[model samples]
Target: MAEAIFWVSFAFVFYTFAGYPLLLMVWRRLARKPVKRGFWQPSVSIVIAAHNEAMHIETKIRNCLELDYPCHKLEIILSLDGSTDGTEEIARQFESAMVRVIPSLVHEGKAAALNRGVAAANNKVVVFCDARQRIHPHALRQLITNFSDSTVGAVSGELILVETESSDDDTSAPMGLYWRYEKWMRGMESDIHSTAGATGALYAIRRELFRPLPEDTILDDVLVPMRIVMERKRVIFDPRALAYDKVACCAEIEFRRKVRTLSGNYQLLVQAPELLLPWRNPIFVQFVSHKLARLLTPYFLGALFVSNCFLLRGFYLIPFALQFAWYALALAGWLAPERQQGQLASRTAMVGKSREFS
Candidate 1:
């Protein structure tokens, strides 16, 4: 039983990180269908959900106004969910015929604000974004073009992490690497059938398909797209539709963000249990293999370590030693602040140089 538990743990960890991507690659090769793209201009309602974003709300409104899509075809909605920090005032400054400000006096959370925005939206295609990120000028156009394909119900934009002085520091570079890996996997998943979820930074969905989420839904980004996927519609990733945001300022902020996200995954299962039912959710295998398996990885990792220690005999001895060395290296790396600081600087320089040429 100990041996069996150890292997299950080991296999789960491997499958979550390595095997899923490999399987996606094979699936894409076998079933990839290119989304029909063209110069199609559709009316879009860009919804910006703001809380206490007084600092960035004005800039975000300006960014929306500057998008390359036709002014007549675009409607910008700033949904302010009780901001004492003058976020609503900042948003109101930009309200006009095309721009609308929907403000609530009480803090009702993002999902509630989004539902209100969707209700206020005049167009069928509603693009959701946050106040913190700047969408690229052509992102709206690129996102809308995906709708030319009838199969696609939503298109998620690429979110590029802009390196800042604070974000380029040691504790955040790994987050950047992880995000890049995630984008690559999302692209693969899109090529095969659909992306499992949409990036909250920038994503567009059909307004008619929009379901009002619970007031406290933490992963609106994930839940919204997955709900569309459940209805046999494709949720695709479009790399050309780009947005930029600074990475979480520090490790603590990033940790909190991740905790909220992981907790939302659990919340999603509770809110939409049918997602795990294979017949109901078309991408059930992908959902379980990609999203749910990741939630189990930490436990699997812990179980592997604990189970391996009890079987330190013959080949088990080698496995135990290797696991010890692997963890030791991770601990050493975590402890070496100076080394990581230098590496961060080097990485920033490399990224800057690459961006200059690209």
Candidate 2:
């Protein structure tokens, strides 16, 4: 029983990070469902949800206005969800026919802000973005091209995380390396069917397909895209549609993000139980492998470590020592958090240098 438990836990840990992606690679080769992408110039509405984003609002609005898309075909909406700061003031300065502002008197969270902004969108495609990222000039052009495929209902843009001048030169830090790996996996999943979710920093959905989110909701990025997937429409990733964001100014920021994501996963299970039912969700296999498995991986790692202690003989000893070393290194980093930022993780192949906040 000890050996059986040990191997079961070990297999899951391995499968979560390595086996699943390897499976995706082989599966796509066997049965690839490619998106029939072509040039498309649909009138687009860019929606930004914000609260106390004064530092980034002005630049974000300008970035939206300066996109390579036709000015006559585009409109920008800023959903100001009760900003007590000068965020509303700065955003209002740019209000015009091309730029619209919707202000609320109380803070309603990002999901509610997006609900309001998207509600006011009049264009065929609504491109959602955050305040901090600087989208590429042609990102809108690249995103819309995927909609030429009749089956595609949404398109997610790639997020590239560049280092600040003050940061270390090594891009192989834990956050940087892990993020690029995740995106690479998402791209593979997209080719097979639809991505598990869209990137909140930049992604476009057909306005008509839009569903208003709960005001207190979390993980709008994941919830919105998966809901679209439930409608049996394809949600694909476009690498050329780039949104560049600076790495988090602090290491603790990443930990908070992880907590939010994990919490949001639980919220999703309660809000959309159909996701777990294979008959209801068309992408159930992908959802289980990509999202649900990820949520349970850390516990699997814990189980692997705990179960290995009972079989500490011969070959089992090797894995036990490796696990010990990994945990010790993790503990050391936690004790001395300063080491988290500049430290180098093992070098590996990277897609684009990218990371995400939502």
Candidate 3:
């Protein structure tokens, strides 16, 4: 029974990390449905959700103003949610016919802010972006091209982590490596069918498909797109549209952010139970394999480790050693210092750090 449990958990972990992506690769090659992309600027409303984003709000506004799309057709809405940090003051500096500032008296979180921002949008297409990232001017243009296809409802722009000049720099950073792998798999998912979700940093949707999220919502990126997918429209990915930013420089900060993200995934399962049903969610398989599997992986790893302890006679010893090695490598990656300018490229490990290896 222990052996059976061990293998079962092992298979699940393997499937979560490897087998699912392999399936996507074969699936994409067989059923690649390319987005019927075309070029033309439609009227767009850029909705930026800012909560005490005083540091990045001004830069974000300027970034929106420089987009390649027509000035007359574009509107920028700064939705401020109870920012005590002068975010409202900086945002008010830009209020005009082209820029609209909507202030919320209380800090209700991003979901509420988004609801307000999307409600104020005046155009057919609403582009949602975070204040921290700098988008490529052409990214808006690239995202708009997808709207030309009537079937495409939401489009996710690529989020690129700023990396060092040395290729070996990212090998020690776990988050950086994981994000790139995730993006690659998501791209394949988009090719074969709809990607399960959009990147929160940068994405666009048809203004009419917008749904008011619960005030406590998390993972708005996934919820918004999946809802659109439920409406029987394609939620696609376009790498040509780019948003650039640095990964969290501090490991502790990144860990907390990831924890909040994981909590959001749990919240999603409760708030939107229909997403698990095939008939209700158009991308059920992808969601189960991609989002749900990942949310459950850490628990599976625990089970795999515990079950392995009961059967450590001969062949079982190999996996036990491998598990130990895996944990050790993680520790080493965390303890490893970032390489200085003149250091050798091979100084970093391979598993945890992503941006350095990017």
Model 2 lDDT per residue over 91-161, tens place: 98999999999999988899999999998999999999999899999999999999999899899999998
Clashing pairs in 2: 161-354
lDDT of each: 0.89, 0.86, 0.87
> Poorest 10 consecutive residues of model 2 by lDDT?
346-355
**Candidate 1 vs 3: which has more lDDT:** 1
By lDDT rank, best first, the candidates go: 1, 3, 2
TM-score of 1: 0.91
Over 199-277, each residue of candidate 3 has an lDDT whose tens digit, in order, gives 8889999999999999999899988998999999999999999999876544544556779988988898898899999
Worst 10 residues of 1 by lDDT: 349-358
lDDT comparing candidate 1 with the true structure:
0.89
Candidate 1 Cα RMSD (Å)? 6.2
RMSD of 3: 6.1
**Candidate number that wins on lDDT, 1 or 2:** 1
Root-mean-square deviation of every model: 6.2, 5.6, 6.1
